[model samples]
Target: MFDKIKQKIEKAKGALEHSDERVLASIPETSGLSKKDIYRNRYNHGVNLGGCFILEKWIYESVFDKGGDNEFDAVSSQVNHSSVDEAASKLTKHYNDYISKIDWNWLKNEAGITSFRIPIGYWHVGNGQLLDELPFEPLREVYSRAKPWDILKNLINKAAEYDIGVLIDVHGLPGGANTDMHSGCKNSSPSFFNKSKHIDKMVNVVLPFICRDACVNCENVIGLQVVNEAVFDNSAHGQKSYYSRAVAALNRIDPGLPVVISDGWWPDQWADWLGQTNLAAKVVVDSHVYRCFSAEDKGKDANQIINHLSESISWPRDRIDFVVGEFSCVLDEETWRKTAGNRDEWVRKFGKVQTSNFANVASWGWFFWTLQFQYGDGGEWGLVPMVKKGAIPRRPQGSPTVDENRVKEIINEHIAYWKDKGGDAMEHWRFEDGLRGAIADINAFAQFDNSRIGRWKALAMQRRAQYISRKGDSKYMWEWDQGFQRAIDEFGRY
Candidate 1:
């Protein structure tokens, strides 16, 4: 079925008149939004729904207490102690109960989270058949009966009820992307980069299925994250190559569906690459920033760490759409110990600074590390606890309403300032058009869930291209660009 779908798309690629048309065609006529337009252009206040599908011992220790460290060991231990059928039943219950509708309500109403990053392994794909030749191959029967993919689909659909978007993250790949236990196995060496077969399965089988089924069948699926936290040095070349193929495969199915790639702990290099590459679909660089893990971070006090973060953390705004995919309020014990204030007060200060920086810099906002843990709310690491403790904001401030009269006042001021200094041939009307266009877009998005528009650069680029194509290119196109940007800049002021 996928082969036939791919063949049809390959043929369609040649027949389409313009690259943008392929994207435009995928959008529903009623909504006037491509998946990218709706999902990628919003400031995402999200949380990672971890320890649900991909097992992590630290997040949920009970499952591992009776077994081994990671998902692989847990399943193996279960099958050894009991029967495969018993193991499957136990795992299935965990999947169904880990996250519930009540939790979704809390996320939406209390936390004001608009999106979720759901992490799943490649073995969770298509009843675990895609695990062939991989380490999880022998344990395929366990997941086959558990039907994780089916449960994930149901979760996506449920998220849509509250107008929440989902980023389907293939956290654990065919071969381990990193040595961490979250990569699906314990103490496994990173071999995904060196193995061609591992790359082939992801580019050919896993990603395509995600694009074709999840993005197509699930309305609230915002995007597909190709891999999570790939080792920076080990998979640099291979990761880049894999991303190129993954983008191509996803674009062929739905040109508007955004493809997300991890920064591999090197944001600048990937930002440079994004600037040079001409991608057909939208791409987001997921950079996970954690201050607790590094030695340098451990040495600094809370104030010093906050100052260092504000000064050092930077994203290449002109190049790529980026997000702080994972972050938390937890600081190293050394840093906390060295601080000269109440621990709760410092936690609040740290969380505020991180959220502020992320909102100001990240094209798409941030997602807290994990939503919940098995034992209790994940304290500083959890979104719920942080929000309750007056750390993270319950919801981002709403975009201020900009009426037509208010827009005219700004336009008049702009014309007055430029009148004596500018050429008579200046297209001031272009500026008015651009300003109105931005207002319309913002208004349209708010109707869905009172959400504000984000990724202004990408939105402007798409609008400018369409505007020029429709109105015919002129030397005064810069007027439209300025008008669009000014509205975005001044959106909440009035």
Candidate 2:
């Protein structure tokens, strides 16, 4: 069985290499860039961006702000490091301790999860607001001390214990990934369109971590996801080119490792993006389905939701595999509202759409939204919580109910089941035959009758129409939209 799995891995690798050829043939190389040329390679495949840095909202705020009764007060209360060695020592213990508390084996074995998305923090690496120039070389001292490779070694060691892969994602761009989260620089203005400035600093400061020995090990480190959810409304061409250049450079250091390119919120954009010079062959397209964020699923049912996923894959289905990247939904109205402590039904609805539609996924796995979040849907994420603020009594989600032991049991069962069944059977059970099982599950629950769901969805649709009228053209119609309707149309009454 192990030998078969090994053979399958070899075949898949070969297929992946050949797929690059096909994609390259379909797309032209950037001028002067060759297959062996690192700058020429511009594709990214694999899972990335869970928690760390920008995603750890509470931690960032708590540790950095001088005024709050925050958890990171002591850590934040120090003079910034003067050298790389000092920075490493300052963060090494705290960082190592954080990972040690995690149930790495359980996360790997039970969650059917592989790949850890570690985010790099700007301040931790010494590029604070005081520095005002490009290349951010002043950060070299801080970065040198912070010991990212050392931390990565520890993370990889733990991950290898469970046979998982690791993908390092640079989360905070210079101006910040978006305006709402601020970790990269002070006076960190929004960079929806001005994100190009990040490339210079990344090349000088961030490239070493990628080229280092700790990162080259394939047994654990799989690839580098350049940045998390790059906002494409700004610098689309520069972002694409920078990614291509980064891939080429990294490939120079480690040829076998793939690079992951995260597209803007709209993944469909990549269909045309693939034909761009130096990008098609080295990329795995990424899209995030937040019935909440995209508002793409307003009133869709299980089958309809799945079909939407299938349709979304039409362009890249043959050439590039996509990562769902993030997804979560709320199922029950009353429970959701009570849990959320407000009327953010859209978020809940999106979660439901995702849970309902996940099976039809062509080639994907998810990192889920965060390790933790603030606001009503707080404590919701990849089975853990970061420091708690916004609500009192900070606690892990499901707490006593969703303990490590229970989560471990769930994750282990899934991992073992997949391992024993092997990827093929797992794929069949999940994609081919799973739809029938899901429909039957929904149908079996008398309370969730199709007719009732339809009526509820209709009312939701009516409200959305009214809302859209007031709001103007928007994608928020969600499960109530045409993408979902087509799915129901195909599934045919019950």
lDDT scores in order: 0.78, 0.43
Q: Per-residue CA lDDT of candidate 1, range 178-225, in tens?
A: 898888886457778778998988889889988888897666788899
TM-score for each predicted model, relative to the true structure: 0.88, 0.54
Q: Which stretches of candidate 2 lie over 4 Å from their true place?
A: 1-55, 59-62, 65-77, 80-90, 122-148, 186-198, 293-315, 330-362, 372-378, 382-494
Model 1 scores worst on lDDT over the 10 consecutive residues at 22-31
Against the true structure, candidate 1 reaches a TM-score of 0.88
**lDDT of candidate 2?**
0.43
Question: Which stretches of candidate 1 lie above 4 Å from their native place?
Answer: 1-31, 34-37, 396-399, 403-428, 492-494
Clashes per candidate (backbone, < 3 Å)? 0, 31
Residue range 269-314, candidate 2, lDDT tens digits: 6646666553544555556654323334444543344446545534
How far out, in Å, is residue 408 in model 1? 4.4
Clashing residue pairs, candidate 1? none
